[model samples]
Structures are given as structure tokens and as C-alpha cells.
Target: MTNHQETIKQLIEQIGILSRKQEAFKYEIFELKNKLDQLQSSIDASDNVEKATLDQTDYVVKSEPIASGHREWIDSNVHDEATIKQPSFQHHKNQNSKVTHNTPQKSKKLSPFRKSNLEKFIGENLLNKMGILILVIGIGIGAKYSIENELISPLTRIVLGYLSAIGLLGFGIKLKKKYESYSAVLVSGAIVILYFITFFAYSFYELVPQTVAFAMMVLFTVFTIVASLNYNRQIIAHLGLVGAYAVPFLLSNDSGRVEVLFSYIAIINIGILIIAFKKYWKPLYYSAFGLTWLIYLSWFVMDYSNDSHFMLALSFLLLFYLTFYLTFLAYKLVKKEGFAATDIVMLLMNSFIFYGLGYAILNDNAIGEDYLGLFTLGNAVIHFIVAAIIYKKQLSDKKLFYLATALVLAFISIAIPVQLDGNWVTLLWTAQAALLFWLGTSKKISIYEKLSYPLIALAFISLIHDWSYNYDSYYHLEDNLITPLLNTSFLTSILFTTAIGFIVFLQRKGDFISSLKEGSTWLKIVSYAVPILFVFSLYYSFRLEIEAYWNQLFSLSELENKSISDYVVTVNDYSLRDFKIVWVINYTLLFLGVIGYLNYKKIKNIVLENSILVLTIISVVVFLTQGLYALSELRDAYIEPSIYYNRGSFYLIIRYISFAFLGFSILSLYRYIKKDDIHKGFKIAYDIILHITIVWVVSSELIHWLDLAGARDSYKLGLSILWGCLFFPFNRFRYFKE
Candidate 1:
């Protein structure tokens, strides 16, 4: 009995253990099945590739056979469930990897947040703005239809327009608490409507007086401004400001009420200036500025007259100028805000517009034309004082200070041309340029240096103008009574060239050039351009001076003997040509000499180097043309003179001076070519030309002397003799070898 009881207890305990193991396996199988379902759903939800791969995958779970005796003891339901859920785990893992690795292409899906935001923009912002625009247009069209068809009386039409505007404004205000952006669009539409209504009331219907309509529109502008501020909407403010400015023009009846119109614009400006100072709204400030000027400019263009409206126009200009001037600088002066590029640009535009308008008005009136310079100078002084104050107070960034300084210089530069004409302008510009350059180097202010460039350019340009003017005035030699080098124009040219040369000298002598970075554009300009300009200016002035001196002599001769023959006139003309040839050749030789010196000093310059090569080609042309003509002149003057030709020692000197300079130029050019790294072919060609030129000059001179000695018929004999003398020595010494 005891043995049988113990056996029963052991069987019961084993059964309990088996039951607990089966329950735990059941929970594990349930969790695995849940994971498989999630994985399958994700694969379906993925892009096309994964879906196609998943569609081909098999999802069967295989069951493993347990020990035969244990399988019989386990519950059939639990066994079936485990078999159904357990085998899919390994297969799905392998298949998942295959699907991932073999997936073809990915399609980017938009995130939920961005997609919703885009929908909101289309629905709220875009649709609302477009709807408001359409509504405004519809109102305008409806009013036009009613006016044309007599659908409503004019007074009633105006009343209904005001009512509609009031309704929209009130609705916008009510919606401001929840729908601020939408409210702004509606409010802007209402402001436009109000502007049209008020304008139509006064101009079209004639139901309201100008003063009353103006007062109503002013009220509307104030209301829009206050509502925009309360709503904190910039779009609303921009529309309100634009409509307010447009009202005056829309209500125009050609009455030309200058005082009223200006007073209204002035009031609007003052209010806008206040708004700009308060809100720091740059767009508002810019809109007001642009619109105000546009209206004022339109009025000035159409209706202004110096006789009737000078004081009124001037007073209003001053008002507007001071208004915007203070508005532009308010942040810096009052709040000590940092200056930005927009501030600088707006301030400059304001200054320029005021000056431009003021200048036009003054010149048109003719009473204050001379004061234009002082007016410009006054602007400079004011700007300079402003810059000084800013610098003294340290109210803003240094850029503003620099801007003010630049404006001062700009105004001063402009004042020069406005006040003076002819060489006075050029002389003053050169002086200013020199002063600026000196200040630049001494004070180490690069703005001064850069500013000097344009001043010098203007000086050079004005000097050219002076030359043209002088040319036109003194076209005839008899009319040229001024001294050669003592006149205003020539002296100014000299001073201009001298100033530029001095600037270049200082740049080289001081640390300025070395301070610049290598290959800088300014460095290249200073190194090459400045010196070239100086040389050119000097050459041009001297060439003209020499020509003038010759002309002076001819003119005096003409005055003494006014009844001379045309032959003598021709002789005098050729004499002038002779002097010109001498001058050109001598100057060219000097230029070549300077180039050679620079090359010898190893001062490498691309321009000067290329100039030498170019000069070689140009010299060939000048020699063939001018040189041969001069030789012809020498023959004509000495050997075969015209009947009225006046023979003198001057003819001999002119004839020989060119050949001497040509000889020196050849030597200078030869040295340059030898020192330079030129092609051997070029050198050989140069040598050939050199020998030809030498033969030409020597043979020509020989023929001229033979002609002078009454041997004109034996020119071939003389040429043969010269050729034999020249080439015999060249062949013997082998001097022509490359």
C-alpha cells in the first residue's frame, strides 16, 4: 500500500511540470506570431520592390516531431499552435535579408509634417491673398458697371462702397484674435476700397468737397496704420501706405493746388517717419520713401514752374529732404543701432534725389544758378558734420562714418565741375587728387587713395575736353594768340601730369606698394598705368606746345606779309610739317631711351616690354611713310625749291634733326632687342630691317647732297657709289651675320 501511494505522488508531480513547460512555450509562440504579423505588414507597406518580394515569399511554419511518447502526452491544441507559429521565424529572417539586399530602387516619401505645412500654405496664405485680389478687382468692375449703366445713383454708390469697406475692416478686426494673417489680407483689401471710394466721391461724383474728401482719406490712412500696428502685419502696412499715397493722384482734377498737395504729402511723410522710428520696419520706410518721391516727381514734372512755384517748391523740398534724412539716421541717432547697407543706400538716394531736384529748380529759376556750387558745398559740409558727430559720439558702426566721409568727398568733387568750366575744373581736380593721395599715404586711409583715382581720371578727362575746346577755338594759326607754355590750358595739363607723376613717385617711395598683396589689381594699376598716363600726358602737351610755337612764327610772318602767294603759303605749311616730324622723332627716341633704361635697371613691366615690340612695328610704318616724305621735303627745300619758297638755315636744321633722332632710336632699339629674350627669327628680321634703314638714310642723304651740287641727272651714279661704299665693308667684316 505505501509503495503504490508514492508512485501516484511522483506521477502527479511530473504532470504538473509538463503543464508549466507547455504554458510557457505557448506564450513564447504567441509573441513570435505577433512579431511575424508586424513584419509582414511593414513589408506590405514598403515601396514596390519589397511588396513584390514579399508577395513571392512563402509564410508556412513547419513543425518538428518530438519524442513519440511525449508527443502523445502533450495536448493536441497546443502542439498544433506551436507547429503553426514557430518555423516561420527562420524562413522569414532569410527572406527578409534577401528582400533587403535585392531591392531595386527607393522612392522618397514626403514627411507628414512638411506635407501638412504645404497644404496649410496653399489653403491659408495663397488662397486668401488671391481671393482678396480678385475681390478688389471685382469691386472695381462692379463700380464701373454701375456707373456706366446707371444701376445705382452716384451718392448711393459711394455710400455702399464705404459700407462694404467698413464691414471688411470690422470683420478683419474681429478675426485678428484668431486668424491674424487672413485678417491682414482682408484689411488691406478694405483700405484699397476706402481709397477708391474717397477718390471717386470727390472726383467722379463731386458729392464731397476736396477738403472733406481729403480729411476722410486721411482718417482712413490713420485707421489702416493703427490696425496694421495692432495686428503686427507688414503686408497690411505696405498696402495701406501705397493706397494712401495713390489717393492724391487718383483725385486729381488738374487744379494745380501746389500748397495743398505738398502739405498733404508732408503730413503723410511725418507720420511715416514716426512709424519707421517706432517699428523699425524697413519695408515700410522704403515704401513710403519711394511713393512720396514718385508723387512729388510726377507733380514736378507736370505742373512745376519757376515763376509761380519756386519758393513753395523749395520749401517743400527742404521739408521732404529733412524728413527722410532724419528718418534714415533715426535709429543711429536715437537708438544707437548698428548701420546696415540698406541704411547707407537709402541715405545716399535721399541725398542725391534732394540735391538733384533742388539743383534743377535753382537752375530753372536762374536767380540761384551761381549758388549751385555753394549749395553742393553746403551738402558736403552737412554730411561732413554728420560724419564728425557720428565719429565723436561713436553712435554706430565705422562703416557709416566711412560712408559719410565718402559722401563729403563726392560732394566736393561734384561741386568743382558745377562751379567752374574749362581748365579751372581740371586744375582743381588735379589739386584735389594730389591732396587726397597725400592724405591717403600720410594718414594711412585707403579710401582717400581709392577716391583719388576717379578725381585724377576726371582731371584727365576734363583736360582732354580743354584740349578739344582749345583746338576748336584756335583752329587757325592767326587766331592762336596765346603763348606756347604760359596759357591756362597748357599749365593745367602740366600740373595734371605733374600731380599724377608725384602720386606715382610717392607710391613707390613710401610703403604703399609693398603693403599691397602680390598680383593685386590696384598694384598693377599703380605700377603700370600711372606711369604710362603720366608719360602720355607729358608727351601730348609737349608735342602741342612745339607745334604751337611753329604756328606762332608762321602767324607772325603772315601778319607782317598778308599778301603773300599761295606758293609761300605752301612753303610755310611744309615748314610746319618739318617741325612736327622733328618733334615726333625726337620724342619717340626719348621714349625708347627711357624704355631702355628701365630694362637695364631690371624693372620688369609687361606694358613697357610689349610697347617696345609694338614700337618696332610702328617705327617701320612711320619710317616708310614719314621718313621718306621728310627726305623728299629736304630735296625739295634745298635742291628743287618752289619759286616762292623762302630758303633759310631753319630748313637745314629741320631736315637733319629727324635723321639724327632716327639714328639714336635705332641704337636704343638694338640694345633693347639684344637684352630681351626675343625669338632668333625676330632678331634676324630686325637686323635685316636695320641694314635697310641705314642704307635708305645714308643713300638718301648722299643723293640730296648730289642734287644740291647740281648733279640731279647723275642720281644713279651717286646711288651706285653709295651702295658700293656701304655693302663692301658689311661683307668684308661680316657685320650682318645673325
Candidate 2:
């Protein structure tokens, strides 16, 4: 029995060991299978390409594989197109509800946090604390010094403040190197502040201050010199330095050899050279050169006070050199930086200077006799050289070589003696008109760029022509008066103005408002004032034009005779202020202003937008009521008590207002009737236009009946367009939105 039990135990032990080994083998096999499955999944995931459609703000992904080997077509939009072949038996076996879990793909766009950092760099602009601090201290300290010193007046201090503001000017220089930016700003700021405070604060029991002030001026001058040497802050440094230069020049007035002036020039020249050595230094060099030349010219004139002829010669040479050197620099800059605004400004200023010099040579016997044809001919050569250089570089910049060429031509057209009928200036004027028209319509240039120039030129021509005609006619006082285009006489100039005012009303577009906004506040006021003034000036002239002694009357303006400008007093027959004519002009202006109202309305088809239409209607009513009163006064002045119409064409202001008012009334009436507002009799919109017309008609009749006021020797105090809130003399504050 014992032997049988021992055999069973041995067999049991062996069987138990075998069973444990088999179970361990099964566990290892299961782990290996899991590892294989995981490896396969990872490879598939790595190989898969996520694809998407680009929306404006988001991506729409299509879970697809990027096609391999067709590399040219792949983008973020590629689709996953890989196919896998499984054995039929294995597929059938593994087809028991196969599960899928999605794996999210990494996106191409960065997270919000990363994007925020990127935006901070680009959007905030020069996140420079040091630069800003320097600017503030410079401006603040300069102001403090000026106020305390009273060395200068308020206007001058403000002007210098603008020029000396060198603090934030690092950006202007574009000093891109990191360490350079820091070192330059810090060192320069420290040196400048110390120099100014030490000098400006100079006083010794206030006794030695005169000497100290003189000494400080020298040291400050030196600092300005060194400041100009600074790569990024030349302009500001120049501003501070110029004040010192100006004080002595003003006191001396070219009488003595101002030694201080020569020192100033030397310092400025050094600054110019320093800036010139930079990788790109056109703007700085040009500015520096310009300042230096101006100073030199001023000194030359002063030193050669006896040698007016030599001074003129030297000035011509200096100016010529200035043109040549700047042109060289301009050509170089265009090559490096391509077409830029700097190129345009440099071109414009230099061209104008050259032309002005040419104009002097052409028109004035003084410069003409000295320079002969050199400024004109030499200017052309310089222009050609610039053109060749620009063309040779083959630059593809949009500013192109054409602007330089056009500017040169434009300048030449005016400055070159148009000896075509030997009536050199008349031909020049004709060419001016032609060129002005061309530039105004040219697609390449902007309206703001050259549009005003032509109009201004036209104004100058008219003024000159009228003044000359007046002199010639008044010398004869009757016979030499011949009406040219719209008759640009003292009387016809006003009427011509009214005609042009009508043109402006018609051409008025939506862009005008934007232009008004973008333009200088003063320019905006003037642009509107042109049309209004034309109307007023015409009415005044027209009423007086019909009066008896008017033909015998003469108003000799301070025309070409500039020496008479200061001595110009209000002489009886020749008062330039001539306010006695303002009232009838005001009345005629009111009578005719409806033209502007209509055209302004028509041009702004979207006048209703932002209630400009309502504003327009209100303005029209206000002015029209004023106009009625004006028309009555005009009749009293121009017409006989017994008869009706006067001699001569109806003043443009009157014609313009009548036609314009009728046009607007018809249009508004049509719109109102269509809206059924008029048929139902005067809603808010209908009544606005109706009231406007009523005011005009009633005022016109009443003025004819009552004759409220004539020639306003003391300005007529009334609801005249000149004084009203709507239209009179233009609202100087129109540029402000409020």
C-alpha cells in the first residue's frame, strides 16, 4: 500500500509541473500577439496623412491618406487613399463586430497661446520702452527749458520742440542690430540730456551767466553737432542746432561775416558725412545737404553783401551741386530700396527747387542776366542722368522711373522759357493748363497728389491775367477790356468762379467727403470755400458791375509790385479788402447756392446714409431763406426802380441756384410722391424739401419787395448765408466730425 501511494505522488508532481509550464507558455503567446497588434497600429497611424479643406477661418479635415509619389499635388487638402488587402479567411474570421477608436491628429495651426505671442510682436509696433522714454524726456525737458529761459517766444519753442524730438526716432533710422539699437539710444540720450541741462541752466549769481550763456551756446552747439553724428537722430539734432544758427543770422541779416554761422555749417557738414557713410543714407544725407546748403547760401549772401552778383553766382553753383549730389543719392537709394515714398518726396522737393530756380532765371532779369540759360539747360542734363541711372538698374518698383521723368517734365514745362511766340510766359501758362489737365486725369498718380496744383495754377493765372488786364484797361480805363474765357476780369473772375463752383458741384463724389476727412483741416475748409466764395464774390461784383461809375472804378491790387504790399492802405477806388461789395455777393451766393445743394445731393446717391440727406435738406432750407433776402438786396442795387432785368448775363450764382434748386425740387418731389408722402401732403422727409423751396422763394420775393440791406460797409447783421450756421462764409470747423 505504501509503494503504490509513492508512485501516485511522483506522477501527480510531474503532471502539476507540466500544467504550470503550459499555462506560462499561453501567457507569453498572448503578450507577443498584443505587442504585434500595437506595433501595426502605430505604423499605420504614423504613415496616415490628415487632409483638410481651408475655410476662411477654420479647417475641415477629411480622414484620408496622402497619395505617395505624386508629390506635386499634396497640400493640407490631401486625402488618405491607401488600401489594405486582408486574406479572405482571415477577414471572415476577424469580421466579428470589429471596433474602431478615433485618434485625433495634430493640427497645422499653432495653439492660441503661441499665436498671441506672434501677434504681440507684429501688432504692437517697436515695443521699445527706452526709445519712448528718451522721446518724452527730450520733448518735456526742451519745453521746460524754453518756458524757463524765455530765450525764445512760444511759437519758436513749439517749432523747436517738433524738430528736437529725437527720442523715439530710432525707428525712423531703422537701426536693426539689437545691441547697436540699445547702445546708441542710451549713450546718445545721456549725453544730450546732460549737455542741455548744464547749458540751459547756466547762471552765476546771474552775473557770469552772459558768459556762461555764450559758453553754453557753444557747448550746446557741439552737442547738436555730435547729435547729428548719431545715426538715428540727425533730424532732431538738426532742429535744436538750427535755432542757434537762426538767432545770429536773424540779427546779422547777411550784413556781417557771421563767424558763428560758418561753425554751424561745419558741424552740419560733419553730420551729413557721418550719415552718408551708412548702408543706406539718402534721406538723411539729402536733409543734411539741404540744411547745409541753405546755411552756406545764407552766409554767402551775408559775407558777400557788397558782391550781390558774386552771391547770386555762388548760390546758383551751390544749388546746382545740391541738385547733382542729391540726384546721385536718389538714384542710389532707388537701386537699393526700390520705389519708395522717400524717392517721391526727394524728387518732388528737388524738382520744385530746380523749377523755381529756373522760373527765376526765366522771368526775372536779375537771375536771368547772371545765370543765363545754365539753370534751365543744366537741369535738363541732370534729369537725363537720373533717368539713365534709373532705367539702367531695371528696377521693377511701382514708383517706376516715370514719376521722376514726369516730375522733371512737369517742372520744365513751367520753368523753361516758352519762347514759342516769344511770349514766353503766355506759352508757359497755356502749357500749364494742358499739363494740369493731364495730371488731374492720369491713372498712375493720385488726385490728392497733383489735382490741387493745376487748380491753384489756374487761380494764379486768373489773378495775374485779371490784374494785368485791370492795369492796362484802367490806364485807358475803358477801351482795353476784352473778355477772354469766361472773362477773367475783377468782375468776371467772380462769375468764372461761380461757373467753376458749378463744375465742382457736378463732380462732387463720395470720395470728396473722404478727401475732406483725409485732407488738412485748413485745406478742407478752403476746398469748400472756393465754390462758396466764387458765388459771393460774383454777386458782389455783378451788382456793382451794373452800377453807373463802376466802369470808371479801379481796384489796383498788390500784384507784381510787391514793394507796395506793406504800404497798401484802403484807398477809395482801390481797396483790396473791398468789403462794401460783400453783401450783394452774399445775397447772390445764397440765391445761387442751391446748385451746390443739388449736385452735392446727386453725387452722393447714398446721401441718406448716416442722415447726410437730412442734413443736406436742413442746410438747403437755412441757406435758401438767407438767399431770398439776399436776392431782394441784389435787385435794389443792380436794377432801376422802374425797370426789371439788368444789363449783362445773369450772374452764375443766380443761374446755378435757380437750375440746381429746380432740379433738386423735381427729383425730391418725384421720390416723395412715389413714396406717397407728397400725395398725402408733407411727411417729415417731404416737408424738409418743401420748406427748403418755400424759404428760397419767399425770401427772394421779400428781398425784391423789402430790399433788406445793400453794400455792407459795416457787415450786414442778419440771417445771411455769410453768418448762418449752415452756409455763409464756410464753417471753419467742418473738418471735425462733431
Candidate 3:
């Protein structure tokens, strides 16, 4: 047996060795086949290329005139393909030969104008320009320190600054010719250093006469602007603007020289505006805007206490406005990029600054704060007029129109609250909302349509603010009461919310159906919100009236001291009043649900239809539950009279109302579930709930009547059995049918 096993093992080992050799042969054969296929494909591709080249040669010769150079180019490509050994290299060589031979004449013509290696070498090297920038700023700071410390004569520092600037300018011009790319940085650095030096020379050290210093500054600005235009680079413009704005801060010595500082800013901005007309540099414009406004705001905040600065503020405001307007013209009219987000932001920023400065001027008693509204209104009017002009000229972009409308509405929103007291503000906002809605829906003016949503939202927010005035009064017991709903404020709030809802509903009619069908999210939101907001307004008005009545009925002297839980304990005492309020709310909800259903029928929106149905069902359920609870309370009150005097009448009313609600809920559930296409499971759930409700209502009434007659326990048991048998079969039948 052992020998036989050894023979078998030997045989197995031999078989394994033979299997390994077989696999090795298979892989080698696969690789060889792949190599053979690649070689075949290469040969085929080469043949196709040659054939294509010959066909092209024939076509070119027959179809059009062929230059000798072009004919030679085709011949050279074919020769390269035949001569090259490696397939890849030969293909690339053929392509290059074809291109070179074809464009030979054009290349010869353009070679002279192409950049040389030396020029590229210099242009790529910016270390020298960066070093010069650092060095110039460092030297300026050092020179300023020397002058302040009296280490060197101011006149000597001034001369050194001039010489350095001149040397740098010359170096820049040389670079401009040699490299061109790095020239802007060098030139800008020189201009900044020179401007700083000139500013200190006149405004700080008094080393030069004011006239001479101003002339030198103007000359530097003119040179900078010219260089910036010549180079067509924004970096030069940016540096020049930064240096110009910085001069005021560097020279500021608590002399309260507001006029001179702003005058300097105004001149610098004017130069920037001119540069803007030539080149559209967003960074340059933004930097000038931010720095100028920041400096002006800083100066106003720090020095506006001095009455002499009023005129300075006025002049600077006008200058800033002009500068912004000019930039606007540059973008809208010159560059014709149309109005963009940046333009809108700049306009808003300008408006804010103008308002801030105007407020400051008024706060200083330079003008009456009451008349501040006049200024705001005037600004709004101007913006509206400008918008009208833009619209008339057909230069209005959506963003531009939106910004313009927003500014006007914002000013109006602010001015109304400030100028008018009491409920007038609310009325104004209501009118504004209506106007915006009208404009948004108008076919004549398309631009305002884009702004309609946001503008209406703003008006709504303003109306909210207007409604807050009556909040304290509506809730207050006595001493805190100020403005009640009987007053104009609350009345206006109600009227305004209702009118807005009406207008929104009217405006949406044209497109609401299409919008709904297209699944427009915003339109759906507005559609739902309008009715809900109107309902909320009515609810709030009712609440105010209820609170007022409650205050008159009870002494709320201890109201403030009680926690919410403590107040809830007393809630049952006013159950009757709450019942009345809830009854009104229930009917209101039902009415709104009906309206929603009608809208859904017209629009054929599933979401709207389902939402209204669900809301109505939930409301009915709640009303039924509350009615039961209220009846229970009334029954208890009749048994133990505290606030009521008619026990018999209270009990009768409770029973009648409870029966009425139970019947109404049952009918509503039946109608809701009877609708076709409802899911079987949901219908079954509704049937089960209705059956349970009917049983409870019947049991409760039986129990109440039985107690009144002093019935025995057997009667209750019999009634229970009867209800179970009837309801169980009915529910089972309903479920199976569903």
C-alpha cells in the first residue's frame, strides 16, 4: 500500500510541473500576438497617410493654384515619413515638416516683431522692481522720521526726495523700453514716493510755500495719470490712488485742516475718475472708493464737533458723489459692460455715506434733524429721476434697475417713519407695497418687475414695524396701554395687510396658473403666504380686541408676577371667552380652506389642493375636540356655579353644541374620504377614526343623560354592547369597500 501511494505522489508532482510549463507557453504566445497586431496597425496607418497625402496633392494641384513652396512642403512630409525608422518619430517629424513648409513665408514676415530672448529674460525678472518698491517706501519712512526728529533739515529731505523720485522715474523709463512689463511697478513706486514727499514738504514741514507744494503735487498727479494711461496698467493707477489718499493722514497734525485734506482727496479722486474713463480697473475704483470714504468718515467722526467743518463736509460730500457718478458713467456709458453687482454696491455705499454725513451735519445743529427727512426724500427723488432717465435711454440693466428701485424704496421707508408719526408710516408702506406690485405686474416697464419681490418684502417688513406700535397697548392692563386697536395704528395694520394680500392675489392671477404648472417655488410661496398673512392679520386684530375686553372684565394687577404655568391654571376660568374666540377662528380657518380649495381647482396644483384639505381636516378635528372640552367645562360650571347664574341654560347649550360638532366632524370626514383616488390605507384610517369618534360621542351623551336620570349600571353596559356591535361591522364594511 505504501509503495502504491509513493507512485501516485510522484505522478501528481510530474503533472503539476507539466501544467506550469503549459501556462508559460500560453502567456508568451499572447504577448507575441499583441506585438504582431500593433505592427500590422502601424503599417496600415502609414499606408493610409501616404494615400491621403497623394490625394491631397492631386486635389490641390487640380482645384487651385499651388505655390512651389507648398508643393515642396507636401513632398518633404512624404519624404520624412519614408526616411524615418521609428514610426512615432517619423509621424511627428512629418507633421512638423508640413507646418514649417506651409507657413515659411508668414513666419519670415513676423519673426522680426517677435520678442527676443533678452527682452523675455528681463520681463520675467521682477526682483529688481519689487526691491525698488520696498526700498522707496523704506526710504520715505526714514526721511519722514529724520524730518520729525530734526536729524536733517526739512529742505534737505525735500531735495533728496525730489532727486530720488527723478532717478526712479528715469530708471522706469529705461525699463519700459527694455522690458515693458516691469515698468508699471517701478513707475508707480516712484510716483507714490514723490507724492508723499511733496505732501510732507508743504503740509507737514512747511519747507515749500503752499502754492509751490500744491503745484508740485498736481504735477506729480498729472505725470502719474499720463504714465498709467500710457502703460495701460491698473497697478500704476492703484498705487497713485493709494498714495494720494494716504497724504491726508500723513499730514494730519490736529490742525483741523479738514478743507485742505478733503480738497486733496477730491483732486486725487478726479484724477482716478479720468483714469477710469481710459481703463476699467475694478480694484483701482474700489480702493479709491473705500479709502476716500473711510478717511472722510474718520475725519467727520473725530472733528465734526467743530462747527467750521460743516462746509468742509458739504463740499466733500458733493465731490464724492460726483466721483462715484463719473465712475458709473464710465462703466455704463464708456465701457458698456452694463450695470453689474459692483456698480450696485458702489451706489449703495455712496448712499449710505451720504446719509451718514447728512445725519452728522444735522446732529451738530447745522440743520434740524426733523428736516433730515427732507434730505432723504430729496435723495430718493433724485435716484428715481436717475432711474427714469436710465429707463428712458434704454440703458437699464436688471441689476441697475433693482439697485435704483431699492435705494428709492429704502429712502422712502426711512423717510416715512422719520417724517411721519403714528400710523402714517404704515399707510405709506402699504401704498409702497401696492405700487411695487403694480409696477411688477406692468407690461410697459420690464425692469421694475425684477425688483418687485424684494421691494414688496421690504414693504412688508416696514408694515411689521408699524404694527409693533400697538403691541404694548393691546397687551397692557392699564398704565402700559398706549395705542389700542381702536386707534389708527392697529386699524392701518389690518387695512394694510388686507390690501397687500388682495393686491398680491390680483397680481398673480395672470401667471399664477402657468407658474404653478411649471413648479415655480417662489410663486407658490407667495400664493400661500398672501392668504396666510391676511388670516394672521385678522387673528391678531381679534386677539387685541379680546385682550382689551379681558382687561376690562378682570383685574390684571398681579399679571406680571405670575409665571406662564400659573396663568394657565386660570385659563379654565375664562373658558367661555376662549370658546367664543376659538369659534371665530374655526370659521375663519374654514373660510380660508374654502378659498384655497377654489384656488387649487383653478390652478390644478396637487400640493395646494392637498394642503388645503389637510388643513381643513385638522382644523375641524381641533374644533371638535375643543368643543367637547368646552362643553365639559360648561357642564361642570352649571353643576358648581361660580361666574354663571343660569345653570339650566348652560347645560342645554353645552349638549346642543357638542352634538352639533360631533355631527359636523362625522360629515366632514365622510366627505373627505369619499373623494376618488385617495389611498386605500388613508381612507381606512379615516374611517376607523370616525367610528371611534362616533362611539365616544354617543357613549358620553348616554352617560350624561343617564347620570341626569340616575340610571343603573346595566343600562351603561347594554349601551356599550350596542355601540360596539354597530360600529365594528360598519367600520369593517367601510375598510373592505375601500
Predicted model with the maximum TM-score = 1
1-738, model 1: which lDDT tens digit per residue?
A: 454455556656555455546644544444454345444533534542334543332232222111112223235534543442221112233443443536656556545767877998999899999998998899889989999999999999999999998898789878975577798889888888988888888887799997788778878888878876766566777776876776677766678788988898888878876775675666777887888888789879988888999899889988888888877777666644556677878888999999999999988877889799988998899899989988888656666787889899899999998987888889888999999888877787777777888888888899899987884455365556677778877787789889988987786673664334579987777677777888789878877777666656555544223345533322344555665665665766666766656755775655666677567557755865686676567557665555555666666666576766676667766775785576666577667778788788777777777767888789998899889888787786465553
Better of 2 and 3 by TM-score: 3
* Per-residue accuracy of model 3 over 1-738 as CA lDDT, tens digit each: 454455556666555445444434444443344344334443545563323433433321222111112233334434443442321211234443433435547565564523654564565555666677688868878886986698978788888888888788888889885456676677777787788778868777788776676566667767777787677666676766765666556555666667777877787887787666545566777788888888877777666754576656776787797678667755664444544566767787788888878766865664556687887887888779777776777563545655776688778878887788767766776677667666656543444444555555655666666556555455445655544456665677677767767665665576533212345786667667766666566656655555555444333422233456685333224545554544454454545455554554565555555555566556656655775566666565665665423346755464665465445544554555677876676576676667666666666666666655657465658686878778677878778977
TM-scores for all candidates? 0.73, 0.35, 0.66
Supply candidate 3's per-residue lDDT for 483: 40
How many clashing residue pairs appear in each of the predictions shown?
0, 11, 0
Candidate 1 lands at a TM-score of 0.73
Candidates sorted on lDDT, descending: 1, 3, 2
Compared with the true structure, what per-residue lDDT tens digits does model 2 show for residues 194-228? 34443334331132244454555565556555555
Q: Which of the two candidates, 1 or 2, achieves a greater lDDT against the reference?
A: 1
